[model samples]
Target: MNKIKQGIEKLWAGPWVPPEHGKMPYFWLLSLAYMGWKYAYVAPGALELAMLVLTLALFVPLYLASFRARGWQVHACMLAGCLFGAAWVRWNPGAATFFIFACAMAAGITKMKHAMLAIAAVIALALLASLQASGNMRFLFLMPILTAGLPVGVGAVMDARLRRSRQELLRKQEEVEHMATIAERERISRDLHDLLGHSLSLIALKAELARKLVHRDADACAREVGDIEASARQALAEVRAAVTGYREKGLASALASARASLAAAEVALEENVERIPLAPAAENVLALALREAVTNVVRHAGARRCSVSLELEHGVAVLRIADDGQARSAADIRHGNGLCGMRERVQSVGGKLALRARAGLELELRVPAAVSSGMNP
Candidate 1:
C-alpha cells in the first residue's frame, strides 16, 4: 500500500495537472465507479469482461496525460480516448458514462465548432448501434443527449470563458509594456537635450575662438582646435552613456575646456573652483551649463576678462560664470537653444539658472547640495 501511494504521489509531483488542479482525480474515480456499477449487470463472458477492464485501464492514463502532451501528440491521444470511450459505451449500452467523459474531454481541449461537430458525428453512430441492440428509440435519442451533449455544452462554455480571460490579460500586459517603452524614450530625449545642447555650443565656441586666434596666438589656436577634435570624439561616448542613463562628465572637465576656450579668445580668466560633492547627474548638468555659459562668453561676449567661481552657500552649490563680454540682442539672449536647455536641465534637479546679460554675460546656476541623492544619477 505504501509503494502504491508512493507511485501515485510520483505521478502528481511533476508539472502535469488536469485542466484544473485537485479536481480531476475525482473525475477519474467517479468514472471508474460508474463503469463498475454498469459492468456488473452487463456480465459478458470472462474473456469479454477482461477486455473491458483492460481497455478502461489502458485508456485512463492516456486520457489524463493528454493535457500535458503537445501538438499532434495530444490530439492523437484524444482521438484514441474518444474511440475507446465509444467502444466501451457500445459494449454495455447502459454504460453511457464513457460517452459523457469522452465528449467533455474533447470539448475542453478542442475548438467549440470542431469539438461539437466531431462529437455529434461520433455519438450519432454510437446511438444508432445502441438503438439497434436495444431497439428502444427514446432511450437511444434522449439518453445520448443527456449523457454526451449536456457535458459537451458545459465544457465548451467554460473553455470559451477561460480563453477570453487569457486573451484579455495578455492584451493588458502588452499595453503596459508599450507604455513603459514610450516613457523611457521620452526620458532619454530630455537627457539628450540636456547633454548635447551645452557640449555642441562649447565646441562651436572653441572652433570660432581658434579661428580668431590664428592671427594673434598661432600655437594657442592649434591647441584649441585640438580640443575641439577631442571633444567631438568624446561626444560619441556621451550619446551611448545617455542611452544607458549613466552619463557623468562633471564640472572639472567643463571648466578645463572653458579655460582653453577663454585663452584662445585672449580673455584673461580668473577661477575659484573647489572639491565639491554632488550627484553625478547634478554635477554633469551644472558642468554642461558652465560649458554653455563660457562658450557664450567666447562667442557672443567681447569681454577682455572672464571670472569663474563655484562655492557652497546657504546649503546649495552656486556656480557663477561672468565675463565682461559683448551684450546680446534681446531675441537671441532670451530664446537661445543653449540657454533654454540650460534652464531646463538646472530646473530638473531643483536648481535655478539666472542670466545677467544687460551688463555682461553673467550666468549663475544654483542647486541644493544634497539634490543628487534623490535622483538615479
Candidate 2:
C-alpha cells in the first residue's frame, strides 16, 4: 500500500531529470524520424519518399547544431531548416504552413532578439506571398509575433523573482546562524561561572583563615588546611564545569565564593549593598573574574591582608578585590591566559574589567544591569 502511494506521488511530482542531462528536444526529434520511416511513408509517392528522406537526413545535423548555439541562434537555424523543408515539399505556394509550425518551435529556444528577427523574417515572407496569392495576412503575421513575444516577457519576469527569492533565503539563513552562535557563547559563559565560582571562593577563605591561625593555633590551622584541601577538590569540580559548559552561577553563589576565597587568604571582605540578581552570563563571567583575581593574589602577592567588595553603583554591579601585597612590577602585571579569558568573558557581555596596582594590586569588574539580570540561580 505504501509503495502504491509512493508511486502515485511520483507520478504527480513530474519527471526528474539528472543534473548532467543535456538537450532532450533533439533526441525526441530523432525518435520521430525513425517512426516516420518505419510507419508513415512505406507506400508514398516517389518524389514524396525522396523529400521525406531528405527532411529526415536534415534533422541529424540540425539537431546537433541546436546544442552548440546560445540564445536565439539555435531557434533561428531550426526555423531556417524548417522553412527550407517546407519549400522543398512544394505543398501549395499558399501553404508554406510548415514555416509557421517551425517558427513556433524556434520561439521556444530563441532569445528576444533572435525571436524578433525570426518573427520579422516570417512576417515579411508571408506578406510578400499574400500580395501574390489570396489569404488573410493578419492571422499569419501578427498572431505569431504576439504569441512568441509572450513567453520571453514571462520568462524574464519569473527569472527576476527567482533571483530575489534565492537572495532572501540566503540572508535569512545567515541571520539564524549568527543568532545561534551568540546563544551558544552566552550559554558557555553561564556554565563556567556556575561551575568554578563557589569552589575558588571557598579555597581563598580557607587559605586566608589558615594563614591567620598558623601562629596562634596549630590544630585550628590544621583544620583550615583540611578545608583548603576540600576547597581545592571543589575548584576541580568547577574547572570541569567550565570545560563542559554546563550549569549556571547565581549572584549569591558568587558572593559566597568571594567570602570563602578572601577568608582563606586572610583577607577581610566588606559588602556595602544587598544582593543584586544577575543574568547567568554576567554572573558566570564575574565569578570567573573573581576567581582569577583572588588566585593571582594568593600566588603572587606577599600581602598579609586583602579586601573583597561587591556593590551596585550607577545601575552597574561592581566587584573589587584588593590586596596589600607588594605592588607588582610592570612586567609582573602582564596578563596570562586566565586573565585574558576573564576579560573576554566580561567583554562578551558588554561589561568592563580592569586590573591595576594603586597602593595595592586591585582587580575591578563592572557589569551593567541589563546584562546581570538574566542569570539562573
Candidate 3:
C-alpha cells in the first residue's frame, strides 16, 4: 500500500514541460507520414525501404536540434520545420508551403506589426507555390494561414498576463514590510517609558525632602536619605524589567507610587480615582509620566500639595499629576532632562504628555483606553 501511494505521489510531482514541448510534434508527424506513404505507394520495393529508414533517422536529430536552441528561437525553428515537413509530404499540395511559412512567421515576428507582415508573406508563398504546381490554388492558399494564426495570438496574450501578476506580487510585499517597521518602533517606545519614569519620580521626591531638612532636623534628614536609597533600588528593578520586556507594571501600582512619593515629600497628595484597565504598554508610559510629574514638583516647584488624577474619558485613560508647587517658567522646564524623558515615554506609546502651570505645576498624560483594558486589573 505504501509503495502504491509513493508511486501515485511521484506521478503527480512529475516534471512539467510546457507549450514548447509541442514544438517537436511535427517531427513525429513526419515519421508517421513516411510510414503511411511507404505502405500506400511503395509496394515492398527497395526505394520504399530506403525512404522509411531515412524518415526515422530524420526524426532524432531534428528533435534534438530544437532542444539545443534558445526558447523563442526553438519555437520559431520548429514552426519552420513543420512547414518544410508538410511541403515534403505532398509537393503537389501548395497548402504545405503555406503551413511552413505560417510556422516561420510565428517564430520570427515577436511584434504585432511584424507578425501581420509574416502572415501575408505565408499567404503569398502558398499562392505562388499553387500557381507553379497545377493544384487547387484557392483552397491551398487560405486554410493553412488561418490555422497557424490562432496559436501565436494565444501565446502572446498568456505572456502579458504572467508579467502583470508578478508586478502586483512585488508591490504587496513592500507594503507588508513598511507596516512591520512602524509596529516595531511603537513596541520599543512603550518599553522605555515603563522602565525609567517611576524610579525618577521617586528620586526627585526624596531629593526635595532631603534638601528641605538639611538644616532643620538630623533625624528627618536621615529618613529622607533612607527614602532615596529605597527609590534607587526600585529604579534598578524597573530598568531590568524594561530591558527584559516584562509587562508586569499595572495602572494601580503606578498610581500608588505617585501618592507615596508626594506624601514622603510632605506634599498633600490627592487622587481623582477611577477603575481603568491598561495594556502593558499604556501602563508603562502613564506610570512613568506620573513619576516624572511628582519628581518635578519636589525638585523644582517649591509648593506643598500635589494631586494625581486617573479617569476614563472617551475610550482613553487620562492621568494628570499636578503639584501646588512654585511653578517653573516654560524655558526652565524645556531645558531639563527630567521633562524631556517624560515626553519621550509618552511619545513611545502613541500618547501625549504635557507640563503646564495654571495655579501650580500641572503635568497631564493621556493614553488610549483600549491599551489600558488589555492589562490585568
RMSD to native for every prediction? Answer: 12.4, 10.1, 11.2
How does each model score on TM-score? 0.46, 0.53, 0.48
CA lDDT of each prediction against the hidden true structure: 0.67, 0.59, 0.59
Per-residue CA lDDT of model 1 for 1-377, tens digit only, reads 99999988988785455544455544554655555555565557898779877977786777577555555664576467556655655455544555555555554444556656656755664565455344453364347556555566466446756865787999999999999898678657765664565467668778887888999999989988898888787767777887997755556667776776677667899998866777776787777787777767766667899999888887788999987766654444645666776787788789988877666677889987764533211
* Candidate 3 local distance difference test against the native: 0.59
Q: Top model by lDDT, which number?
A: 1
Relative to the unseen true structure, what is the C-alpha lDDT of residue 86 in candidate 1, on a scale of 0 to 100?
A: 55
Scored against the true structure, residue 156 in model 2 reaches a CA lDDT of: 33
| lDDT digits (tens) for residues 1-377 of candidate 3 | 99999977874574222344444444434533433432554355676467546644664444444433454665565555455544543432323532543444343344556555544555555545444444443444445445643454345334434544666788888888888777655555544554455566667667877898999987998988888887788778766765666646655666667667667767887777776777777777776666666666665677688877788788777888776666656654544656676677677678887778667778788887665354322
* Residue-wise C-alpha lDDT for candidate 2, range 309-356, written one tens digit per residue: 776788887888888778765555757666767777788889898878
lDDT of 2 at 42: 46
Per-residue error for 242 in candidate 3, Å, reads: 2.8
What TM-score quantifies how close candidate 1 is to the native fold? 0.46
Model 2 lDDT-worst window of ten:
89-98
